[model samples]
Target chain A: MSELIRDFARLPQTWFETPIAAIALTLAAYFVGVRLFKLMRHPSWFPPVVIAALLIAAVIALLPIGVEDYNRGAAWLTLLLGPATVALAVPLYQQLPQIRALWRPILMTLPLSATLAACYALLIAWAMGAPPEVLASLAPKSVTSPIALSLTEELGGSTALLMGALMVTGITAIFGVEWLSRWLKIRDPRLIGLALGINGHALGTVRAFEISHQAGAFASLGMSLTGAFTAVVLPVVWHLFV
Target chain B: MSIMRGLLWLLAFLLLGQSMVQLLPIPLPAGVVGMLLLTLWFVRRGKMNADVVAVSHPLIAMLALLIMPGVVEIFFVAGRYADQAGAILTALLVGTLLSVASSLWLMRRYMPPLNETDHE
Candidate 1:
């Protein structure tokens, strides 16, 4: 078994050289992860994204391929992020009447929540003795991945570390939001969705959709507005304070 | 075909958003600006087309998967920060929970009560 494992690892790198190989590997891993998630009854214990990422990570770790190579091959999928983000407006538009009615509250909540997200991350990380870069990365963890990555870049933080922090933040919001809402007696779908979107970003939006259309609409609204507010404000704040 | 049209709309808005970001003085993300632009267009039109809904549903559903590549980079990069992993994790957990709790608390306190017809 050890010899076989060594032989597999020593296989020619040419087989995995093409971008197709990378894309195929990602899709296969993600599908398998989704199957496992469903087989496990879709428990919050292992979200498909976490499973897929781990599987891909394991494969990349064992293979004789560099991170840059893998990322370059997978660039096509990442490029869709921008269009997908714009696609979010469909749901937001559906909920516009309600949003317009509550525009005052949402406008007020956006900056306040954005500030809280940045401050809580910075202060907690600072107290924990996190280095400056880690603190900067954490400051934008609550925003969507695309915007978060951009914010991290602007603030001179490590994009990879910010990605990890985001995964943690997203998973926590996915599993914890409901329990927290019940505990806090948050009954409104709008507020519940808003909390999840503000804290979890895209992952939280996915979970919010599972609850109801109304919840999903509000979640998209929260996610979009928070991303806008954070993207515009975080770099300036980071420069001034951190 | 309708999905294609819907995609075209998304792509167009994305381009417009990118142009706006480059032209405007404020530092805004193109994606968010595109979303806002689409929202305003939808508001002015007074209805959402089914084609946009058709395309957006699948896109949003698979949103998490689309971000996996970036997340996977963490595995490659996390080793450098191994010493600080515990601190990072602690901050993430505490900060996330606090942010969610505080946002929910504030929104509930300040937002007006929902109308009877709003329960949908």
Candidate 2:
């Protein structure tokens, strides 16, 4: 077994050198993760994203290829993040009437929540003695990746660190918010979705959509509005303070 | 063909968004601006076409997979931030929880009571 494993590892990289290999590997891992998730009855402990990322990370770690090479191969898929974000409008469109009715509450809450998210991240990181770059990267942690990466880049922070923090924040909200909502006895899907969106961003929106269409719509709204709010406000505040 | 059209529309919106982000002085992201623009267009039309819906549903469904590459990049740079990894992780956890709790509280406080039809 050891010999086979070593031989497999030593095999020429030619076999997995193409972009298709990277894309195919990602899809394959995601499907396997999905299967594992279902086989385990959708346990939160083994969310597909978590599993797929870890599996791909492990494979990339063991292989001779660098992260940049893998990303270049996978760039085709990542490019879709733009369209995927725009696609969020579909749900938002579906929920337009509801949103119109609740626009007051949404508009009122979005900026406040956005500010709070940034402040909490910055203050907590500062108190923990995190470097300024880390704090800046974290300030936009609740925004989705593309926007968060852009914001972090503009602020001269590490996009890689921000990406990791964004995922952690998202996964934490996904796993914990439902229980917290339940504990608080918050029954409205709108509120629940809003909370998920503001706190979790894209991943949280995915989870919200799983719960119901209404929840998904509100989550989309929350995510977009929060992204816009953070983009406009965080830079101004960061400039003033740090 | 409908999916193709939908893709084209999405691509056009994406292009417009990117251009606007560059041209504008405000700090808005292209994606968010695109979403807002799309939403406004839909609102003006007062309905979503089937083709748009067809394209968007699948795209949105696979969003997590789309973001996996970025997440995977984290593993490569994880060691670089090892000194502050503990602090970063703690801030992420605590800050996320606080954000979630506060947002939920505020939404609950301000959200109006749902009408009977809204429960549907």
Candidate 3:
């Protein structure tokens, strides 16, 4: 018993040793989780993000891995966002011909979608008797993270909630776009892009790629438009309500 | 011909965001502000093509998944929101319904049937 105790004591603490290695291991596990999710037919009930979350949770719980250690590695993946978001331009350009033809429809849809998203959140909150701050954060749920967070903070909503809401909104739209598009009979890539981008934020953009190159482009355009319109419109509406 | 020019246009849009983030009031985060600014650019330009359309898709697609890393921090803030989960869940459910319904309405309003477009 004493020997075993001594051997155990020799082991370094979670945060103390090989912090980078721990992060690398966690990220590796995340990659595996993503692959496994794909194998499971990318089941709607257990999405890639949800699966990743569960797998990461089990890892942290079962092992002595600290989050800080894991974050060090995973965060490097996040730095790709700036370039990736910019890269969406390639697909946007590819679909430009189709977009030009449907410019009239595209122009009208952005504001309508943005307005509905904002107003719907507000109306639902009012109906359910939610407080103003909650409504404020909810206001920007349909837009992307940066804008959603900004609006949440500005209206004194919980940034954390806004973040969570952003994730949920994005993920749902990611999965939800196909069904919505089919039901709506939307064939235009620009419209698909706009709807997903506006309504799904970033997540919809992800799903847009699975549909087609054009669909993906429109998703990017829509997302940017949604973010932009919501940023401006939400504030004007917030002032009116507050 | 203009496919390459679209690249320059995208660079301009991205830079416009970076520059304006510093200028915008109301503490709007720059990326979202940039996204908005980009939308205005699209509306103003009002032109599209295959190459032009393909430019931004992948970037946005990958970015959608970028939120995964942030979920780890949720544990830290989870406690503060525990009491309000009901409200949050309600907002999600209600908000989702409204989103789908509104999207459906808009699609019906603007888009003609695909077969009809081909016929025309």
Candidate 4:
């Protein structure tokens, strides 16, 4: 009986070491987050992604699993992000007219804002004496993951650090935009979405969807424009200086 | 199902993007190139591509879920960089706040009100 019970206890350990467990844990955490967000009446502070992360952290604390186990198996999830990011074209396409009509302001807003966001973080981090690697990672923090990620690698920043910074940027933008817009008495979804998309990147776009579809559409536009702008500009500048 | 068809179409675009990145000296990633290619393709047609839409809708709908793992990794990473944590946190917060505020102001200044354009 002791032998049989011990074998049964070890089964979960073996399974948790596999990729299936990692992927399954992620999906389960996310769905649980979704339900909880709804239960809490869709508060920004309790957004699904952050809640999901917390849930996964809880799993780590409760079980024998380490983040490495999940990291090893969960790389496939990162691959899926590439194609999903490409699908953003759908929203960009859907918002064509608004994009076409507001071309001037968007053209104006993107270059300056994208440059401002990147420069401010880089300057602050540098001034505060962050190591060069940290500064490099911070360089692309404002751009969406897919684009910023490639830049991060090219710039020799840590992917893990960039991922953390990217999340912080998005979550911060989501909370900050809501609060700032309210304080300034700004009501335009277009304006709010631009702020979110430009500052938050994809995460901001995700949050904007919760506000309204109009906001969602504009946010996607903001994200794509910012991504493209940074993709072109950052590398040339980096190569020139380095 | 149409879902598979949509994914296949996206894959082709992704592949094209991958190849372009290889052949050219562009700074853009394959996936972003893929997105821009599809967007330009749709622009020429001047409409949404139904096939892409089939996959995109579900993907976009679950985007938060898709992004969760990356965010989850933050838990593990936050501690490793604890030394620079304050600088990193302050920069992200202040930078994001200033960026958003300035961007919003610029949009409001340059563009007219929401009703002024066919934004929806």
TM-score on alpha carbons, each prediction? 0.92, 0.93, 0.77, 0.92
For model 4 the local lDDT of residue A98 reads: 78
lDDT of 3 by residue, A117-228 (tens): 6676667667877777677767788877766776777788877678777766666665555566677666666566667777887767767777777777777778777777
Error of 2 at A55 (Å): 0.3
Compare candidates 2 and 4 on TM-score and give the better one: 2
Query: Any runs in candidate 3 off by more than 4 Å, and if so which?
Result: A1-26, A61-73, A180-190, B1-16, B24-61, B112-120
Let me know the TM-score candidate 2 reaches against the reference structure.
Answer: 0.93
lDDT tens readout by residue for model 2, A123-182: 878988988888878888999887788889989899888888888988888776887889
Please write out the lDDT profile of model 1 over residues A74-172, one tens digit for every residue.
887778888888898988887777887888888887789978987887887799898887887888888988788878888888988888888999988
Please give fnat for model 1: 0.79
Residue-wise C-alpha lDDT for candidate 1, range B1-97, written one tens digit per residue: 9999888888999999999989987466788789889988988888887777788988888787788888888887788999988888888888778
Better of 1 and 4 by DockQ: 1
lDDT of each: 0.83, 0.84, 0.65, 0.84
Which residue pairs collide, candidate 4? none
Give the distance in Å from residue A142's predicted Cα in candidate 2 to where it truly belongs: 0.1
Clashing pairs in 1: none
Task: Provide fnat values for all models in the order shown.
Answer: 0.79, 0.78, 0.32, 0.72
RMSD (CA, Å), each prediction: 3.0, 2.9, 5.3, 2.2
